[model samples]
Structure formats: structure tokens, C-alpha cells
Target: MTPGRVIAGPGGGIPWDLPRDRAHFRAYTSGKWMLVGRKTYEEMEGWFGNRTPLILTRDPSFVAPVPSHRVVGSIFEAIELAKRNGIGELVISGGAEVYETALPYADRLVLTTVETEIESDIHFPECRDPENWTAIHREVWPSDEENDFEIILQILDRKSR
Candidate 1:
């Protein structure tokens, strides 16, 4: 979340602008296995080619696109699948619940803080503590014709246990 703690507007609408999309792609989405909640996956249509999708849901009969995606009942199952597939970098592309579930174990957070005040129904977890996390990368993107607000991309790494 940005200083305002807004991630999505009502009905899962995105609050960030276009430049943030590209920044997000470079920072978190490319060449990674993304663990997403069922609603999140559904919102995304299916899966994108750059990253594999692991859908996490409690619905036992939930199905995902064949040969490319799969559904997991728990985060443990998702991690185990990542291990089996030899995925070193995993992305938790979230809808609120999944982010909260993975927050404690997440090693890094790639956040694009948009400088704007907007109402939102879903908020990113306020679990980041300045004392325990370090910002390793920071880039500021100014608003242009295509973007409404300035965006700051920060990659935060949790301090060693």
C-alpha cells in the first residue's frame, strides 16, 4: 500500500495507473510463479504466459486451465508445488486474504506506491515494519499523459531471522 493504504477500489478495481503496471511487471510478475486467490485468478481471466498461476481456494471442486495452471487448497500446497517445480522466486499476487496469509513468510515486497487519495475496499496488509525491513531498490515515476499520479517503486527485503 501507499501512504494511504489503498490497493483496490470497490469491487476489486485497481487504484494504480498504467506506468505502475509496467513497473509492476518488471519488479514482480515477470518469469515467476504467482500464487493468487481464487477471486484474483478469476479477475485476471486465466493465466498469462510470463508467469505460472497457482490458484489458492477452499472450494474443493475448483478448476484451473489445464496443463498450465492448478488449484491448491492451502498455501503449504502452493509452496510445495513451487518446490517441486524448482521455482526459486515466488510471487503472491493477491486479493486481500492471500496477502495476509503470506505476509509473515514473504521475503520481499515489491510495492508501487501511487501518490493519490482514493477510496478503496481492499487494502494491503499493514505488516511492514521499518525496523525489520530494508528498502533495497527505489525508483520514482512521475505522472504523464498516460498516468494520473506519481508512482514510487520500492523493493523491500525482510531482515534476516
Candidate 2:
């Protein structure tokens, strides 16, 4: 979740560099990692350690490497498992569907709105305006590479009910 910044990864706008240097990288995530899929969770292994992971999957073939992960039958099941396990912070990663299902429960959303709309087969969850949420901050940054457009990082917080 490391700071939970989301990105669309297309077009031109501003620019920012990815920090390959470990010393400068700031991790902004805590609590049990409740990832939405086996693949998505596995890809982020570098960011996880002793933190337990809740993986949502009905596929019998999906096997996680450690006992720290619990495979669930459905998205709702994973949410229940996360709550039962006392997880306060969660990040909804891709496989697309997972993000759609988990967005309802996220209190904080970090979105990267790209300038160029690269047509993808999949899209992130469509979040317009919910009664409980509002954009708290939106800052622009340059794309990591040359010719790529700028991207906007948005932080949305849940307005108190």
C-alpha cells in the first residue's frame, strides 16, 4: 500500500520519478494486507513481510506460499475475514473486479488520474461522488518516462457520517 497512490499510467501532464533507491521510498501502509487476488498479492511480495494477507479467490488451483494468507470463497468472505482478523487498513488491488467490490469499504482512496486515457481492456472502479467521500487533496506529478504525460494523484477521504 506504500502511501496508496493510484495511477492511470497514460498520457501527458506532469512528471514524477519512481524511487528505485530504497532509502528514499516511503511506505504508507500498515495492518494486515487484504489483497483481492492471488496474482495481485504475489506481485507485491516485495512490500510485505510478517503481515498476514487475506486473498480472495474461489479458484482451487490458487495456492499462496505461506500460512499467512487465507484464500476466501468470495469478496464478501474476504472482507469478513479481514474484519474478524482485526485489519484496520486495507488496499484494493487489481484483477479489476476486486477493486469494484472493495471500493465501498475503503475509507481512503489514492487515485492517479492520468492525462492520456490509454484504452485498457479493464478499468479501475468508477467512483463519482459518494455521500461519505470527498477529494481531500489532488497534486500533479510528471510521468516517470520521457514523452509520457503528467499524472494527478488524488487523495479522497471519507467524510464523517
Candidate 3:
């Protein structure tokens, strides 16, 4: 996401490329159960190495291309699937709707805010309410030859009930 919370540009793809941010995303989500919308799952085709993905879609006829992947009808179904598989944590990686649906159930949010803002059609759901979350970790990375913009990576944990 950018400073403006833009996740994807008008082209329906990430507008910026930050190698460090990509690396961080890969490291953090490796071997984890990831929940994503169908469009996001399609966009990320062939990217899943050892990670399991639960793709959320309203279409009951939709089938995941990968044998290891599962198609779920909703966020709750995805969570249930993960739990049934003995997964203790599920990473919500999204394309707006999925983020919005899962935000309330999230225990932690891992976000990367790109320093610059650009025209975007897709935005991340707002979940920065101080009453609901507390920043647990934050790190800033400067722009380099491989990355066009500086990025601020943050991990916010949901406030205990």
C-alpha cells in the first residue's frame, strides 16, 4: 500500500516496485497459510512455492488451478479451512474486498507503506484505529537502485479484548 493506502493502480496491479518490500513480504509469508481474493489469487499465479493459499470467491463453481490451493466462499470459510488444516495463523493478503472482510478478525496487520502516492483504483481498507490496534514494529527503508521509493514497514497487533 502507498501513503494514500493505494494497493493497486488503475491497471489493477501494484503501481510501484520495491525489491526490499517484496523480499520482506516473501520472508514474512513464507510457509504460511495465506487468504486472498480470487482476483489476487489469479494475479499471483505460480508465485506460491511452499505456501498454502485459501482463495475467497463467491462463485461456487470456481476451482483453484493449483491442487494445493483451496477455493473458499467467504472469509469465515477460509478461516475454518485453515483451522481444519491445523493452521494457527492465517495471513490475509488481499485485493480490497478480502481485506475488508478479514480486517475485523485479524490479530495483526503487516503493512508496507510506499512513500509516494499515485493514481490508483484499488485501496487497502482502513484499519488504523488506535482503539483496535497498536503498532508493534516499524522500520523505514530508503530508496535504492533497485527500489524507486522509500518504504515504511509496520506490524500492528490488534488490541486485546
Q: Which pairs of residues clash in candidate 1, taking residues 3 or more apart in a chain or in different chains?
A: none
Q: Order of candidates by lDDT, top first?
A: 3, 1, 2
What is the lDDT for 56 in model 3?
Answer: 89
1 or 3, which is superior by lDDT? 3
lDDT (Cα atoms) of all candidates against the true structure: 0.81, 0.59, 0.88
Give the lDDT of residue 100 in candidate 1. Answer: 85
lDDT of 2 at 56: 74
lDDT tens digits, residue span 1-161, model 2: 11222332324211234442121222444444656566566656566665566777768787777766677777777767777878766666554667777777678876655555443345566665566788898877665654255656678898863
TM-score, cand. 2? 0.67
Evaluate residue 158 in candidate 2 and report its C-alpha lDDT on the 0 to 100 scale: 87
Which digits, one per residue and each the tens of the lDDT, describe model 3 over residues 37-120? 999999999998999999989999998898889899988888888889899999999989888888888889898989997887
Reference-based lDDT, residue 119, model 3: 87
Q: Using TM-score as the measure, which candidate wins?
A: 3
Write model 1 residue lDDT over 2-71, tens digit each, in one string.
5777778876757566765566675567778999898888888644676788999999988786568878
- Kindly indicate the candidate among 2 and 3 with the higher lDDT: 3
Taking all chains together, the TM-score of candidate 3 against the true structure is: 0.96
